[model samples]
Target chain A: MNRFAGPDGNIETEIQKSLLNIDGGIMNILSTVIRKTILTVSFVSLLPVITLTVSAQELNALVWCDHADDKLLKPFEEMHNVKVNIKTYEGTGAALSIIEQSAPGDWDVLVVDAPDAPTVAGLGLLEPYDASTLPMSDLFPQLTEAPFNYLDGKRYTIPEKFGYYGVAYNKDKVDPEDMKTAEVMWNPKYKGRVAVYDYYFPTMQLVAISMGISPDNITADDLEEIRKRLLEMKPNIKMVGDIVSVQNALVNGDVDIILNAAEFVVSGLMPTLPSLDWNIFEEGGLMWIQGLSIFKDSKNKDLALEFVKYVVSPEGQSRLATSECYWAMPANSTTQLSDAEREILRWDEQPGYLARSVPSTISRPEIDAKMLDIWTEFLQK
Target chain B: MAKESKSLKPLHIDYTRWAFHPALWFTICFFIFPLAVMLAISFWQRVYGRLSATWDVANYVKFFGSDYLIDSLTNSIEVTVLTTVISILLAYPLAYILAFKVPKRIQGILLLVAVMPFWTAYVVRSYSWLLVISENGILNVFLKGIGLIDQPLEMAYGQGATVLGFVHFFTMLITLTIYANLVQIKSSYWKAAADLGAGPVRIFFRVTLPLSVPGIVVGAFISFVIAIGDYITPQILGGGTDILIPQAIMLQISRAANFPMASVMAVTLMAVVVLVYAISAKHMKMERV
Candidate 1:
């Protein structure tokens, strides 16, 4: 007999009679289903907590995608005997918003744009640490004592990973010589074959450099000229996108050049596609630096500091520089990288690049707002 | 007589009246509450990355004043409308065949095949489309191999590609809705029309098409609502050549943490959807489908 058959062995009639009995039939089935759904949803939502319960301690870090690599995290996780829960975000605005939405002590560690460290510290989101404890001399000299990392003579954050905002392009498609200068952004020869990286800070600064204006000296009046120059390049531009999209454009041969991108965008792919290359402009390059800091309200300050130290160590720095997501230069000059890896990162040229480039500006609110407005206009154009 | 008739009715309360309470509460909690919050936030100000409760309309004013900001809405409408029209045109015929010509046993399999695209991740689906239509993509390679042109056609990173992606997804949605409505339609109506001296074409024109209007409207309306608000499809497939309203809203939140501006854009998008709903409400028979 079928399992669902009734006592009399008449399946159709029994099922009909049962359904007719509303008290024991449809309503019961519906309520059971609803109960099961709620139970399932509740269980699924509690999964992270369940995992955390098995671990001795948990360190929650808000970081960039590079820090989420298992290779970079697993060693530290094993050493500290703690579970690391990482939530990755892009852009300072988004990171700040995440911190604002979170309760105190919810996040123990933070990785942010090095330039925004002071702004964050001002908001009382960061905890200061003693610089003497760190390998201060081992770090790239330019990154060690920037004004952004300090507030009222106290160090709030330390530089972790650094790279340049330059051009990544197909060497076969565009002249390597032309890539050396900022004016290649609007070079008529490569018109309709350029994809600009969709970050307002670096792209505007790069354009300002092309027009002989430094990023730090960008006033409200400079914006009109910048806007005109940006709009003029729209005809040459095919698309403006994030890292992945811009990378896809170069890989797929959709565009010859990716403006405001560099080794961080294409280094991972260069081994497979030899024609792909990146370089800073003759005028100047904008250096992007990421910093690591502990949250001011962190309950696990000791564990957070341990994680920070581990990230800045030679082994951690090497792992992070060649992380699965993207590759960039480590902030520590003594990081252990393979010869090929160092070559791809242009390690030998760092001193010259550092000398020629200034860290990307962290603009005041009014200037940032105006720059964003012009960027929005640029995208629409 | 009226009093006696009233007394003849059952004295027990009808419990079915409370059946819709869960749905009502769900809407109140999920929809009305969030919308209210968004409306409130739209009037606030964003100061140095934190939301300040100024209760001013500066965000809205800025949105209206900026041409580029307004362009995002226009672009969204253009893409969404094109997607809806093209989807309905493609879906109606497919739904007609599924309802009338296809065998009953195989219809289930065919419908499943049609909606199989929905099983994949939305972002993955968009990227797949990009791969198929990109410069060095299969389409160009195939065309080039056949001597179709000297230069590859620029297909990806444009409004056209965005529409293509939307049509691929939403056509299946519309097909299912229209098919549901078409199957529910009794064949007797067609036979009766035929017996009354109407030809097959005339019968379909007079009976089937008119009766299927509800399905068309409902599906088209849903396509409009979803496509207008979608961010991923356009962001990946459209290649950010032109920004959509959702992209603009994300820019505000992600780049500026300007919740007030983002909320203003959200409210505007919701208003457009509501306006479209109001226009289509008369032709809709949501429960029937």
Candidate 2:
């Protein structure tokens, strides 16, 4: 301090200090800009990844059209912030084939008819549902203990809806008194005037029931007899179709009667036609129950179970039942449905109607893989 | 003699020629690889609800064993043969008219009319025939109004309806092929034949028919292949009585989930089509020579 203490020394020391300060400031500003840029780039890159992760967490489900209402799933979706994807199938077999092909976690939840649940479960496609986890008490008592969903007391499916499958005819062309039974559909009088479903199982079952053979004990021999009956009915049949074409035929008077049709078809057509009627045969008709199932390989098991719980909930069942104009019989025993709503759904406890509504006595025959081939061959011939 | 010659140098191999070629490997990966995989799948076995790699001939054996399958194959052949013959017979006259009789100004319009159906969906065209032939259809109403019959003829879902549908759909292609050949045929050749004292039929057979053979051959081949593979038309029109190969394959895959069996049927059908095409190609070559 004594030796370098001069006017020039003071100025030099001050200039060095200022230069150091500027250098430090420039470095700090450059580093901050670089860090911000990196953070912005990283956030942009992570946008799709984050979105995919969220979406993957959502349960993916495929169901038949008109099976469930979309709004019923809003609460479940919102609760877990998970999306629910519902794809509809035209027919049970069509839905089954898709599930079979895309097996092993392809779908989380499936809406299979009760008849198909055992078959699908037998194929090792369905996972055992945890009853304790869901509100099992809210389901309809009949479905809660239905044989279709229970295999050795383990429920693979939750029964969702029940309906009757039989003849749906135009009231104008076919008198209600004359159409007391499904036998009139095959009468020679309606030759080339009637419509029937082309599917083998339903058509064959209807013919079997009409012939006084319980559909439950159908075998290959029974199929042969049924085939002969079908051949007999073929000349009188104008067209074989599903609900849409059948309804169209009924409304347009293209066909007088439709064989092996569901009551919902008649219900839907009643508003427009108002003259259409449904008939349950004396031998009884096919009582179908459709249910919900979870795939064995579902990644979002919790979400799927939660969604199933919501579907079987009283509110959800009512929503589905009201919207689809069909019965969403809960599997739970305790869930209460109002008398007005039950009346609207035509849930009268009539002994005659209930007795007639017994599920088709037709045994779910072990479908021979070769049967379709054989049938196609016979039909083609 | 001592001068070096750059023009006489041999060309070098250009290894980098395909450096920028995008479709070179893309086409192979997408088309060829999938075809190879399909071929491989056709040879695999299905056992106990699981697919195994054990190669077997069971699928092929099963396909050949079924009378339904054989019937479908036979039906496909019969339909194709009928469609080809009918299309040729109908197309030749129209082609002759367009080339030798119609004015040049109307040829474009005529050709456009022939090709107009191609713009529509094949299914729509097939189903439209239903409305034309059904009991409550327009054709029935008109026929009944004119007192042609006491009852509406059940024309839909029958062999006759199927053949008619095929003829309606495929005749246009045949006409276009024949017409293209007809336009190319020189008028000078026909005039020369006439000048040499040949009659109309003789000139047509000697020059016109022989020259139009290539077009006829091409059209017939295309029509035959298309008709053979067609399942939708036969399904819509052939009634429950008629079965086709595609339908059999569809039944196997869709209803039975027997993909191996379906693959076998598909491969067999492909083989049959290829064999038929080879025979036709040979015949065409001989005719050309």
**Which one is best on DockQ?**
1
Best by lDDT: 1
Model 2 chain A scores worst on lDDT over the 10 consecutive residues at A325-334
lDDT of 1 by residue, A227-262 (tens): 899898888898888889999988998999999999
Against the true structure, what is each candidate's TM-score? 0.84, 0.73
For residue A252, give model 2's deviation from the true position in Å.
6.2
Please write out the lDDT profile of model 2 over residues A233-265, one tens digit for every residue.
666766554465455555545577877774666
Could you tell me which residue pairs clash in candidate 1?
none
The alpha-carbon deviation from the true structure for residue A203 of candidate 2, after best TM-score superposition, in angstroms, is 2.8
C-alpha lDDT of all candidate models, in order: 0.90, 0.71
Candidate 1's C-alpha runs over 4 A off are A1-62, A73-87, A92-109, A295-310, B1-22, B47-57, B195-197, B286-289
